[model samples]
Target: MEETLHWQPAATHTELLAGPVAEAVRALADDDVHVAAIDPGLADTAAFCEKYGVALDESANCVIVAGKRGGEVRYAACMVLATMRADVNGVIRKRLDVRKSSFAPMAEAVELTGMEYGGITPLGLPADWPILVDSNVASHNRVVIGSGVRRSKLAVSGALLAGLKGAEVLDLATGA
Candidate 1:
């Protein structure tokens, strides 16, 4: 799958990424991270993998979840393989210590992360938001994820993602 796409150094192709995502790539300064341009209309996981010949398990999805308690709301990014769903109502709700937790609205997620709706990635999320990585994803050798823009995707080592500043690898996936 990696050889199927024309991969370029993410740090050098900032134009293909949303502002915050590009900045995050630059900050990481990791040469192994790569990016590939894709048709914006096919950015969704199913379409992308089918069109690009990538396997479902090789791609990770980043879901933005909002947890609310009283009048306070907190947001977090959950990274799980496309083959599994995040344990939102169970693990995440308890982790956030919130009474109610659900996927954040599209508009709220886009606005808060400064990333496009289908292109939100854990790499550049707000520093305060904890990035919950599914243990399966964290153990994978490589995985593709959104690049903060629908027109491109980032390819990175699972280990690198798990090592991000605020990332926490956990048993956050179910139905695998």
Candidate 2:
């Protein structure tokens, strides 16, 4: 096996506090990456910032789901910030068009994302999935997201990140 990164580089996964967080750290890379752990669900991006001493704007939230309209099936995994919410009823619904749209269950989410229920990252998502990224994320120089586990997160630049992930940036998400 590789010796792994010895020092904290400019871009690499951080520490492993064990559990899902640890798994995420390993998932990010060998070194130069940093990982932060906080409350579960990562529902509160601001809180995560306070706890980890990382900028909220530099953090990213991974959104995953499946869309079905008639016999057509579309898998979408979006990465946005806590500042904005995905337009589930607007874009997602109209795009999927099943009379209604809702979030996928934990089991389905995990199965579809290939990442943990609470720690789904857009980086490693299935290539076929239509990764939607918000334009807002591009405003920020960098962002953070799950390393495939709720207990861990990885930071990366918005431009470099979205491009690397092959994400399609759009006004996909709208507000309530």
Residue-level lDDT for 18 in candidate 2: 29
Query: Clashes in each model (backbone N, CA, C under 3 Å)?
Result: 0, 15
For candidate 2, lDDT tens digit of each residue in 1-176?
11121223323333433244344345645353455544565435666567556665566777765667777666677767766788876776665555666677779878766667656776656666667777777556667776666655665566645564457777765542
The regions of model 2 sitting more than 4 angstroms off are 1-46, 95-99
| Candidate 1 wrongly placed segments (more than 4 Å) | 1-3
Worst 10 residues of 1 by lDDT: 1-10
lDDT of each: 0.93, 0.61
